[model samples]
Target chain A: MNERLTYESLIAAKLEQLAPLPALADDIWARISADLDREMPTDESEAPSGGGPSLPGTGGMLWPGLGALLLAVAGLLYWYSQRSGIPVPAPSPQSVPADARPASSLPADTGSPKGIYQQPAAVARPVEAMPVPLADSAAAPSTGKLPPPVLPLPDDSRPQPAASASQEPPPGQPPATAGDKASPPPAIDTPIKKKPRGVTGISNNDYRIVPDKKDSARKKN
Target chain B: MNTPDEDIQLIIDGCIANSRKAQELLYRQFYGFAMTVAMRYSRDEMDAADILSHAFVKVFKSIQQYDAARGSFHAWLKRIVVNEGLDHIKARNRFDSPAELDQAEEVPVDHTVVEQMSAGDILQLVQKLPPATHAVFVMYAVEGYNHREIAERLNISEGTSKWHLSEARKTLQQLLQSHR
Candidate 1:
């Protein structure tokens, strides 16, 4: 306790005996007033010296103006999504109508331009989820075993389709023409339909189903 | 002319009303006393200035909460300044790392040596202490905060606060001995 008293008193006396503290009044007030101006910005009487006079309040329309701008941006986005035929995700899943589910839930309209683009996404599902035609089972081999299901490879490993007419189609799909083979497939999952290979008279060798290139070109034009 | 107390009361009322002139008056009135407190906790004048600015801003923003009956205005202002200084030290990431606890045994200082040194000389030596030690010493020796209050403020145990206080005295004693 004596040690504490000794040092504490000594330091206190020295601090008191020193010359008066330097005046930082003006310097500190300048800085603090600037900070005060920033915090209480609505206090026009306190705006920093040399700054332009405070502008009159806009009669509290700032929020309404911001709300209108936000609404306009939302309207524009909806219009663009409709014009481009790109589906806008509904804000709430419950608000999405039964018929308005993703394109994957709709029938594969192999005939429509929309279907052509959406087919690859459908094909990208796991093999078990794909709809195998009932006829495929009857087309199995005599030994009572089905042929191996064709699996899609990742893009790096998939063979790049050429404009060759000789590329045989999957069993259910009609033969593709040279023009149909020339157009590139959609950049998503491969458009190749799964083949149940034991179907009679189809070659035992691998075959790729090419998307209808002629139709794709027609749709693009 | 109003008494100084009455004038300060009026200033406080002006501050609550968001009067710019009243705030400037209050800041000017207290600047020296507050800066002296801040300089003790800071490493240098510039840091002291920064702490003082932040503390005054707090004072203005929270002026509505200052109750005259609880304490004098200077006591309240001093509390805010000390808190701001501690915050500055914490922000610089300096309050946590102390030398191992075993190394901080209390050292008795020769009072004659400290008495001979001017405040500026002692302040420079205190600034040379590790940041955590500096904060602990100022809170304990100068500001009269007990170990428990220091611990609560710095978010350490009382034992740790005592350890830091010891560390500060040990370092300051060494510095003073070298000066002698």
Candidate 2:
């Protein structure tokens, strides 16, 4: 009995008794025929140039615009190159002065003292000029030495005779150098210590300028 | 001078040649069969008509692909019409949820019960099932497809197809019992 209720029998019976579909189907067929007729080309010659029409903005026009953009970019690059100055070449090692070599180029000390004090004495001469007046003042310290005389020197010292120029002092002013004395001290006997101008890390006495080691030692303590 | 097969061949040949007269004749001749296929899958006359037209257009475009060696032209065209109608229903996405079948349990239907119900009543009741289940049931039962064939056509599993058909039968039985 369950087998008798098969899906096949039901469908077969339905197919046999199904109502006709003429009017609905005819309307459908008419519409399809009409649409096909409308869409089909009227003349073979008027059919689209190719099998199918292409999408807009995808063909010839796009290529030309892209090419023009590339040309414009290349032209801009050329213009920028022309307006800038020619590039200068970098200097080679041979072009640099001996003295101008970087500090790192100096030989390492390696704890040796051979050239440790090789800095020139001409660099130390300025220290002597500062102490000349101090020596004079110390000699007269008991009298509370008068303030050093301020005298303006002539700009044309090059033309003056050396001997007479050495003998004269500014009016009512004491000699700053011994040349103004009735009997000047022998030039060689004076011990002049020239302070090196522009050289830091040294005192006025021309000492070998060591760092303040005492302060660092106290900090450690 | 004309066997039915020869007559159908002549109509088909005319249609291939873009003969409007032959197309009109063919449309009239198959209108009943195509409409039955459409009506079974559609909700109303207008919808059925639209499905029929679309199916015919597809048939015209793909007529060259059809081989008489494979099956009868009517069978081939009927397959196309059914597919188009199913596609239309799917595009509309008008299936009911399967939750309604919760109360639908399978019953033992005897030959007497099957005999009492008309084909129209059974089809109407089949149509009332959820869309996915109804499609599977029609393709499997009415169209005489195996589970694998129905599964391939509908893009569902063979198990799913069997389940849908089972649920369809249960629902159909319940509807028939109520009608009685």
First chain of model 1: TM-score?
0.25
- Candidate 2 residues lying further than 4 Å off, grouped into runs, are A1-8, A41-221, B94-106
Q: Categorize the docking of model 1.
A: acceptable
| TM-score against truth, every candidate | 0.54, 0.49
What is candidate 2's lDDT per residue for B44-74, written digit by digit as tens?
6687788888888787666767788899988
- State the TM-score of the second chain for every model: 0.93, 0.84
**Which residue runs of candidate 1 sit more than 4 Å off their true CA positions?**
A1-3, A16-23, A46-221, B97-104
* Fnat of model 2, as a fraction: 0.49
In candidate 2 the C-alpha lDDT for residue B164 amounts to 74
User: Taking the candidates in order, what DockQ does each have?
Assistant: 0.25, 0.20
True contacts kept of each: 0.47, 0.49
Per-residue lDDT of A216 in model 1 = 50
